[model samples]
Structure formats: structure tokens, C-alpha cells
Target: MTMKESERGDGGPGNGRPDTGADERPAEPAGLRGLAALLRPRVSRGQLAGGVLCLLLGFAVVAQVESTGRDTTFATARQDELVGILSDLGQRSERLRGDLRELEETRAELERDAEGETALEEARERAATYGLLAGTVPAEGPGIEMVVGDPGGGVKAINLLDALEELRDAGAEVVQVNNVRAGVDTYFLDGPGGILADGEPLTAPYRFLAIGDPHTMTTALNIPGGLVKTLQGAGASVLINPRAKVTVGAIRSP
Candidate 1:
């Protein structure tokens, strides 16, 4: 009731009974307090945005590294291996060029051979034609043969000459009379007992071998007033035979 009692009474709220109201309030659990402190925001919007940007940049850097690895084929290859590959490619290119050169040479040779063969063939054809025309070689072709029988000695040199002229006009290339070759300058005359053809004596049954178109020669001789009719009128029997192949073996001396 003295000064100490007065001091206790002067303390506020329930005379300071060790503040029981505050102690009576429930104390928060340690785990709940720690959870609430972690949920409380410590960073601003700007700092959060900066953190997101840095994470994205790290991911981009990792993606770039992977892409570089995929794009370069020989990125991990050794220098010696690369050099060997280049050498192999050079060898292959050289082989291809060699094959192309060989093919070109073969084509040129074939062309030259074709030209030479053609020229040789033409020369052979010319030789054959010249030989036939010059009467320097034996010739055979489709033609006609005439056998004249003069029983009454009425077939003279003039009759033989007329027959020869008609044959030449009818496309006769080569002509022979009684095994005597008839050239471009042949003549006929009346001999002692027969007719003379190209200065060679020819008796009755004068055989004429003419090389030409058989049908044309036969038609020319057997016309209405042709050489066959004239020879028949002179009391001479003429027999003509068309031959598939007529050989004129008689040749003029060169």
C-alpha cells in the first residue's frame, strides 16, 4: 500500500500481470511460419523478367551448339583422312577422262575406216565397168543368141552386116560372131565360101552372141519389117534363143 503497491496499480491493463492475454494467444507453428515467409514476395517484376531472360538465353546457347554439330559433316574428321578422300576423288576424275579420250579415238578411227572402205568399193566398181567396156575381160549377162542357116548361099556379107547393126541399135553391149570378137571398128565382106566378119571367116549357121536386155533385142529383130524378116526373105532361116546368161568369152587383144 505504500509506494510499491502504488507502482503496480499504475501499470496499464490488468495491473501488468505478466501480460497473460498475449501469451494466451495461440503461437504459430515453426513449419507454418517458414512456409509463409517463403511465399512472401522478395523480388520485384523487373528482377523476375531478368531471370526469365537469362534462362532463355542459356537454352538458346545450348541449341546453337547442337545445330553446329549436325551441320558440319567432317567437323570431327582428321586432316589425313580428308586428304585421302581428296586424292581418291582426283583418281576417279582422271580415270573418267581417260575413258572419254579412248572413246573419242575409237570414233575417229571408225569414221576413217568407213571413208577408206567406201573409196575402195568405188574403185572396184570402176575397174569392173572399164574392163567390160574395153573388152579386156570376159563378160556375161542377159541377152540373145541368133543362129542363121543359109542353105542356098544367099546370106551374104550385107545380110550379116544388117543383122549386126540391128543388134547394136537394140542395146547390145557386147557382140560376138562365130567365136570372133566384134569391136567398134569391125567390118564384114563376102569371102570365098562364106562371110567375113571382122576379117575372120564365118561359114553358114553363123552364130551371133549378143549381151544386152534379151526382151529388147528379141523384139527389135522380130518386128514386122525388121532384120529377121529381111533375112528370112533372102532364103535364110533364122532361129533366135533368149538366154538368161550369155557369156562372151572372146576378148580383143590389148
Candidate 2:
């Protein structure tokens, strides 16, 4: 039972094995095989075109169905009902426009009213200030009340005038001396029995009501060489009382 060399396998020496020669073809890659299979044209060009046409037709049909459904609501509505809805919308729009106009008018009126009220208040304040300054109206505020006692009857008109000037310089807003309102044209003269303040006779113990800052007026009079010192040097008694509220009710006649 001997086999010839040619009958033996290629490995020789009684070896038996499958041949792996260079003439055999190599196996294709899995990815390339799949690509080649896909390139083999499983679907004809006419069939692919037909499928695409079918998909497009389906989409067109769906869109048309949606459009028809949307139109069906208004189509089924009664003509009179549609007209009523439109009329209601128009009325609502007109009412909104009217409300806007009314709001604008109200805002404008409020602005005008505010401006007018502010102007009126300012005018009233100016009038009050002018009246107080002109000695046409009574004034009351924190001020000093002075009583000058002339025991020797030696206080002349000039001394009184100097005191008035000092008070005016110290920011006295309103001054009244024994029922006589001091004005811009006020004058004093020595009368028969007493000194005359603007032609009005004021005897001993002349009372002065000055409306202004009490502390300021008090300091101004008490300074050295001031009204208080001058009056005291003249042998006249000066009594200055700072009052929280002093009224100059004497008004100058027009």
C-alpha cells in the first residue's frame, strides 16, 4: 500500500494537507462585498422613480386634506353667523380705539390741571410775600418785642430812627411801633408831649413789634455800639423780649 510521490500531498514525505498556492484568489472584504451587493441594482430605475413619486403624492394628499379640513369650518358656518362675528370684531376694535382716545384726553386734562394748580399756588405765595413786604397785610412769626421807656423824656426822634434802621438792617420783615406801621417813607418828629412815629404820637414806653428771626434781631440789637447800647447810653430803659410769636397787625393806609 505505497503511494507515488505525485499521489502524495504537496507537503511531501507522506504528508496530506490542502494546497494554499499563489494561484488561488483572495477573499473580498465584508464592507466591499456589501458595497458591491448594493451596486448590483436591486431596484430598477423605473421602480425607484415610481416609489419616489408615490411618496411625493402621499405628502401632497396629506397637505390637501389638512387644507380642506381647515377650510371646512368656515365653509360650514352660516353666512349670517359669519357676518355677526365680523361685526362683533369691528365693534370691539372701535371700542378699543375709543378707550385709547379717552385715556389720552384724561391724561392731557390731568396734566393741564396740575400745571394750573401749581401756577395758582405760586401766585398766591407771591402775593402773600408782597403783601407782607409792602406793609399792606398783617404778619406774625418768631420775633422780638421791645419796650423803650423814656423816664427822662430825653429820647428824641433821631434815636428812634436809628433803632428802626438797625432793625431793618437786621432783616426785619415787619415792624410796628405803637400802632404805627413802619413803611418805606416813614418819618419821626418830636411832638408836644411825646415823639411822633410817622405823625402818630407815641408817648413814653413805646412798644415795638418786629416780625423776623428772634435770635437774629436780639443779637443785632445787643451788639457793641448797636441799638441796645445806644439806647441805654441815652439814659433810656430798653426791655427786649424774644417772643415765639409776635404779630405786627398795624397796616399802613393806602
Maximum-TM-score candidate: 2
In model 2, the Cα lDDT at residue 99 comes to 100
lDDT of 1 by residue, 59-140 (tens): 9999998999888757687999888988999999999999999999999999999999999999998997777667677889
CA lDDT of each prediction against the hidden true structure: 0.89, 0.88
Poorest 10 consecutive residues of model 2 by lDDT? 5-14
Model 1: ten consecutive residues of lowest lDDT: 14-23
Task: Compute each candidate's TM-score over C-alphas.
Answer: 0.62, 0.66
Judge candidate 1 against the unseen true structure and give its global Cα lDDT, from 0 to 1.
0.89
Candidate 2: tens digits of C-alpha lDDT, residues 31-110:
99999988996788999999999999999999999989988886888999899989999999999999999999999999
